[model samples]
Target: MIEPQPTRRRPAADVQHAVERMRELARALPARDGIAVFNRVYLTVTEEVVRRSADGLFRDPLASAELSARFAERYLSAVEVAAGGHRPPACWRPLFQLRRHPGVRPLQFALAGINAHIGHDLALSVVDTCTARGCEPAEVEGDFERVGQVLTALEERIREDLMPGPDLLDIADPLTHLLGAWSLERARDAAWAAARVLWRLRDLPEVYGEFIEGVDSSVGMVGRCLLTPLG
Candidate 1:
């Protein structure tokens, strides 16, 4: 049975809380578990955001913290939904469905998770942050951009570290072809565009519902493609 979500949406407690949540999740999952792979990637980025915020990196630390926490909450919430034996959103189903498939590489799991999060969760998170802060999406754009920069930088490191060497996966491998098809920059750009669209549709609840359904299914489709295994 699916557990009901809270009626009122709230900002996650804070960025450190998000860090702790991901940490606990990582500890619970097996070392090479696909979800764990993605969890570690996200946790590292959250920890960095905490470090940079302490160093006074963001223009508005408090708002940035809230934004980051809110973003993490979406992923965490999806985890909870699945943990309770209910289906997660369409955007999240591919990773959960394929997490244990031995044929799929860790890098594939990690990227598929990112595809779902960045492609779907991100735009919703922007709207989530704006609503929680009682501001418009435009007002919240700075923090969003800063968080994106943090994610973009960490993603490069993740790719370098997680990618198999050419000896293991040759240039002609299907994995190589799959990797070439997706771009983090393009996903981020599309997310920003979706965020603005969602913001505009906020008043029309039915329209917003239909629009996000498309985003969820489309992102999930890409995630499925990312998880396809090859020899």
Candidate 2:
């Protein structure tokens, strides 16, 4: 006779608990504080992406040292902006120079995609709440649509920038393993960091309701997509 097998643990229970906690947090937030909270969260996520990319890109001894230095400076400036301030000395100019470097282009494209997604989310959330509250719906819709268009354009630009040429596969082969692992880790951390920042916005009364409602609605939509029975 065979010995009884140990039962397998279900991870879904943990996920469900996390989701429930998120819903509770969403419900606890007040209405007016959403936009600021979202902006801060979005900025935090973007800054993390930039920081990780900078670190990874600079680790290449063969890469442009000046470019890395400029990127670090720009990243710091962006961090300042994220901290409720302006970019020092126009850091975006130096940051844009990364696009010119073949080695740095892939990371730039990835960061652009991440920023576009964040902007799209923020714009749509604003539009959703404005419409829900019967406040300047048409203007908000137009702005939201424009933001979506901009996001689409940025996505296309990034795709074109990142398209590998004939020699790219060979050049990338050496660093592929390391870059892949780092990018995945960074993306995961960025997403969670963003979520935590948004969660903290629950304390700010002015943006709290909108943030909670927007997040709750987003979560609900995701849940519906996941929980719907296969047709």
Candidate 3:
């Protein structure tokens, strides 16, 4: 029989607290575990953001921190839902579902998590940040871009470090083709576009709600494909 999953409360409002939560989760799981792999990547990004924020690197520090926290909360919330034995958002479905699949490589786990977060959660977080701060998306766009830059850098390193060795580069290699089909740059662009659309649709709650659902489902579909286990 399946065990019941616990639903944890959302992370605290403080960015530091969120960082700690991520750190704790990363530490609690095995280093090579799929979810732990992604958590470690995210934890690195969060630490960098915290460091940059402390150095006053962001134009809107408050917005940046709030955005970061809200964004992390979404990911955590999805984990909580899954832990509670409930379904998470479509975008998150892949990671939680395949997290323990031995055939699913760590790189796949990391990339799929990044895909789900940036493709779906980031856009919503942008709008959430705007609503909480009573400001426009444009105002927090810099913070969003900054975080994207960090993710982009880490993504490059992830590919370099986790990608299978040169022997796997054959034209028929499914990993190559699968990884090639998804680009961080393209996903980031789509996320930014979606964020703008969501902000514009803010006044139309019904329309906005529907749009969110569409984005989540579409991104989730891509994530599911990305997590397809390679025999």
State the lDDT of candidate 1 residue by residue for 88-178, as single tens digits. Answer: 9999999999888989998898899999989999898888878877888887677677777888888778887887773455777888788
> Candidate 1 — which pairs collide?
none
**Top lDDT model:** 1
Looking at candidate 1, what is the lDDT of residue 53?
80
Q: TM-score winner between 1 and 2, please give it.
A: 1
TM-scores for the candidates:
0.91, 0.26, 0.89
lDDT of 3 by residue, 91-124 (tens): 9988888888988887788889999999999899
lDDT of each: 0.86, 0.35, 0.84
lDDT of 2 by residue, 1-231 (tens): 999997732323322333343344335533223222222333333333334434552232212222222222333334346435443222122323232333443333344324323322333333334433445434333333333343344444433444445334444453343333333233333433444455456458568556545543543343222222211
lDDT of candidate 3 vs native? 0.84
Stretches off by above 4 angstroms in model 2 are 1-78, 81-105, 116-134, 164-231
Residue pairs with colliding backbones in model 2 are 30-208, 30-209, 31-209, 32-206, 32-207, 33-206, 33-207, 33-208, 34-207
- Candidate 3 displacement at residue 222 in angstroms: 0.3
